[model samples]
Target: AQSVTQPDIHITVSEGASLELRCNYSYGATPYLFWYVQSPGQGLQLLLKYFSGDTLVQGIKGFEAEFKRSQSSFNLRKPSVHWSDAAEYFCAVGVREGFKTIFGAGTRLFVKA
Candidate 1:
């Protein structure tokens, strides 16, 4: 079985401040990890992913994540966050070439002006 956990249910950050969202996973094998962002009423958009190779992977909208096998973690980070960056983030884990993907509860980010 595969599962993802996002400990933070909600986070508030000042505009232009650095931001980090924590994600942890449990899987029997090397799993495909992903970070996705969704607006209030919109569909999810892929922020980044890690299948193999480099531990650190870059993503869209100035986002990046590092895959730590030892810790079973894939945390997302941004040097600076904007008000527009506020959204609900979900961490997902899936088997390679498998259709089933398990997503975390999600972390909602609130940015203050």
Candidate 2:
């Protein structure tokens, strides 16, 4: 079975500090990986995604991620985080057909001023 895992339940970081959110996935083959953010009651927004090509991918809101096929991990990173970055981050894996996506439990990010 395919699944996504976010080891961190919550993370607190000071404004302007760098942030890294870990994500791991288990699948029979390399699947489409994604990073999404949900702010409060808002819908999940795509931060970044990896399907093929370069392992490093840039995303919205100063976010970036690197996909490691060996480790089956796709970690999200930010050089500088803002207070507005506080939100729930989810790591997901999906298939090209039907676009069925499975999301991780999610990691809540807390930004401190």
Candidate 3:
């Protein structure tokens, strides 16, 4: 069975500051990893994914993540954040042969001006 854990339930960041969200997973095989963001009253959008090579992967809105196999971690990072970036971020692990996905509780990002 595959599972994911997100330590932070919420985070606040001043506009233009850096951001990092933690993630950890447990799976028997190589799992499909993904980070998604959802704005208020909006659908979730894919930020990035890790399936194969290159431990570090970049995504939209100036977001990036590094997949660490040893630590079973995949943490999201941003050099600088904007007020518009305030939203709920979820760390999920995808499994083959299933349409459903297991999502973490989520980290709600608050952007301060």
Candidate 2 residue lDDT tens string, 1-113: 78899999999999999999999998887789999999999999999999999999999999999999999999999999999999999999996557789999999999999
| Tens-digit lDDT track of model 3 for 1-113 | 77899999999999999999999998877878999999989899999999999999999989999999999999999999999999999999887757547788899999999
- Root-mean-square deviation per candidate: 1.1, 1.0, 1.1
Worst 10 residues of 3 by lDDT: 94-103
Model 1 Cα lDDT, one tens digit per residue, 1-113: 67899999999999999999999999988889999999999999999999999999999999999999999999999999999999999999987555788999999999999
TM-score for predicted model 2 compared with the true structure: 0.96
Candidate 1 TM-score versus the reference: 0.96
TM, every model: 0.96, 0.96, 0.95
The lDDT for every candidate, in the order shown, is 0.95, 0.95, 0.93
Cα deviation at 22, candidate 1, in Å, is 0.3
Off by over 4 Å in 2: none
| Model 1: ten consecutive residues of lowest lDDT | 93-102
lDDT of 2 at 46: 93
Off by over 4 Å in 1: 96-98
